[model samples]
Target: MTLTTSGPSSSSAPVAEEDGRRVRRRRHSRYLLAPFVFTVGTAVLFGLFFLWPGVLGLSYSLTDFRGWGDLEFVGLANYLELFQDSEFYQSLGRTFVYAVFSVPVGYVLALAMAVALTSKGARGKTPARIIFFMPWLVSPIIAGVIWRWMFGESFGFVNYIIQLLGGEAVPWASNADLSLFVAVLASAWGGAAFNMLLFIAAISNVPQSYYEAAELDGANGWERFWYITLPSIAPTSVLVILLSSLGSMKEFAMIQALNGGGPGTQNRLVVQYIYETGFERSLVGYAAAASMVLLVILMVIAIIQLRISKRNNAW
Candidate 1:
């Protein structure tokens, strides 16, 4: 075998043709220098946290993994078994329901709160924003645990209020239907502030010219909002919807703590289901399949949102 290698050649002319050696060189230089450092940094972080876990999950998905001895190669058996599981389907259905409730509701509430606080020269805006965002800063696990206490059957502050009002205290986290309702409510409460702050910043950055022109046209508050405010913050809305949908579908901590996924698994979020299947049940391969199923669902919804929102953005 013979190896021929060229070291950095100081005598060569730099290439410059568009779509040729030169353009490629230019693109390579411009996009591939400091960006290479960033790419490496990103790769390291992603590999450590995300990509490595994903690769492991994928490999596990192809085997009859029980986390001991040799993992038997089972191809798609885990997936097929997951699909056949009634609990898996119910958990998935519940996840979709959670997404339907949480994503849009969170976006609307956040947008409204953001609009309110971001009103030009609005007083107390900073304080209100801080208060709204406080929930987001708290750990999700802690929030779930706290909410569980607040919504618990007998001692819950919520039911206490209902009882004081001469209404019967409803079991917020104990009933099948009520647990899902409470989970949605808790998710919205905990999540809104974070998206609200994003919206506030996005709206604030909108050029004042849009609002000024709307006002000069004798537009009322609603009219100004419809034309100026909505368009100005449309991209932020897209971002919030995309992120919240993904988060909602995989929600676990709150739902798990709130009612342990049910009065009978009626409130089982998909992540909890995956956790139960993998760790609790020692079906790691099955859990991996569930994770892939979630990824596909999220990708489908994300693609739809991006296309629809991008088209709407053009209008």
Candidate 2:
């Protein structure tokens, strides 16, 4: 008697097809793995650092939480008090003044320096660029200290020059009004170099052919610059303006080092006031409220800048 095997044969073709399917699934998983890791990593970082801190800060601002005590929910009391405080308003005004003066002056000087440096007829351009940029390399606080000495009423370089010209010594960091001016000047000095570099790159990208055509049409240097150079670098100008404005708005280190926000809070910027309130006086809730206000102001300014950029097609 002949007996036949009942089990089905394991063919190579069927096994190969199963293996190919497994391999394809693994390849598809690998394709998605990198992006998945990146997405999760970015979310974790943002939540840990930025989002969580911001949420905590906003929460604290709504409470009367002293640095180490139990938090008491006040429900906008801190904000109401902040609006009524005269010192806060004064500091805000001072910050505005600083931004208004420093931003434009810095931009203008930087544009001029960039134009000169990018000129084909220029000599010692590299050295000049280095010298201009050197101030920016130094920390803002350190620059403030050095300039404070320079502006010293007695035995200072600036005063010495004034005396040489039969001029009286001027108190730069002492008087409130003059202190603000000195801060603005020091800030502008370092800021100009940064804007200069940006302007140089922007100016360089403008097609030389445009200038050539303008020249052929009997356009003078000034005309070509007005009609071509300015328009070409308009986007860069906006960027520089935004950066400088933000820097001026948040100016703290320079004001601190220059005069320690002293001479009776005359030179105090809003940030300095916030620091004094939070750390020195231990008014954590009030200071947090002030910081939140500043944050809102900054956000508004950023939104305005973005809108302007979009309108101008700068971005």
Candidate 3:
């Protein structure tokens, strides 16, 4: 009788343990299911939109293909042509110039605006921020149009004001020298708002205690800002600079709408040149090659920026 009771108890204990394991496994499966689905969905989207198109573009770059039809492999002919193209080089140089002229100037302006607007003594901060940020909300094409109107030679508001002040009507878009300058100025005007907001947020997050401590140490406003404020927002500044540089590098819509790379290609950025090549001239393969070159340059810049950010622990 004792032996029989012991056997039943041992068997029951084994069954209970098996049931507990089954329940745990079921719970783990439920927890993993949602993440697995999400991961698969994200991978599929990335492949469809970005990875697949990039691979196809790379393959097409090595060919003599127009937009469509039979493809013939040309084996670096397009790259060779690109290397010999003076217009392409000129456009690339112009893009670099725009990035250089606009990005830093825009960053400084944004930082200044952020500091001014965030100060405790500032009046109508919200309205000021909204007005400053309005240009960014407008479409690039529209902004270009607005600027084009403002900078018009004969009947423009700028010319009207100049006439009032007895200054000459500056030919902003028509003049080759000033056209590039105008384009860069418009880009900076529109772009500064985004960086301003970023700086405002970053500046706001800096602890008030730091400023108070600096004050206690007999630090002047300039010294406090140079040491504590600048160092605190260094990471945000780097991020803003990187993004602004990238945007400036690929400037197209505003340039297109403002000058259309006109005054004899004076304002032509690389993207606009590529667009005209690929769509207008029906030189898809050549454009693709140029695009690949630009892409590589951008990738290198991005890698360098990432390395800098990592070194600074900005991630």
Which digits, one per residue and each the tens of the lDDT, describe model 2 over residues 7-105? Answer: 445566788899999999999999899899999999999999999988888999999988997999999999999999999998899889878888888
Q: Clashes in model 2: which pairs?
A: none
Q: Which of candidates 1 and 3 reaches a greater TM-score?
A: 3
Model 3: per-residue Cα lDDT over 202-280, one tens digit each: 9999999999999999998889889988899998998998898888888899989988997878779999999999999
Candidate 2 vs 3: which has more TM-score: 3
- Measured over all alpha carbons after superposition, the RMSD of each candidate to the real structure, in angstroms, is 9.5, 5.7, 4.3
Candidate 3 lDDT for residue 43: 100
Each model's backbone clash number: 2, 0, 0
Error of 2 at 246 (Å): 1.4
Worst 10 residues of 1 by lDDT: 10-19
List TM-scores for all candidates, in order. Answer: 0.86, 0.86, 0.87
Better of 2 and 3 by lDDT: 3
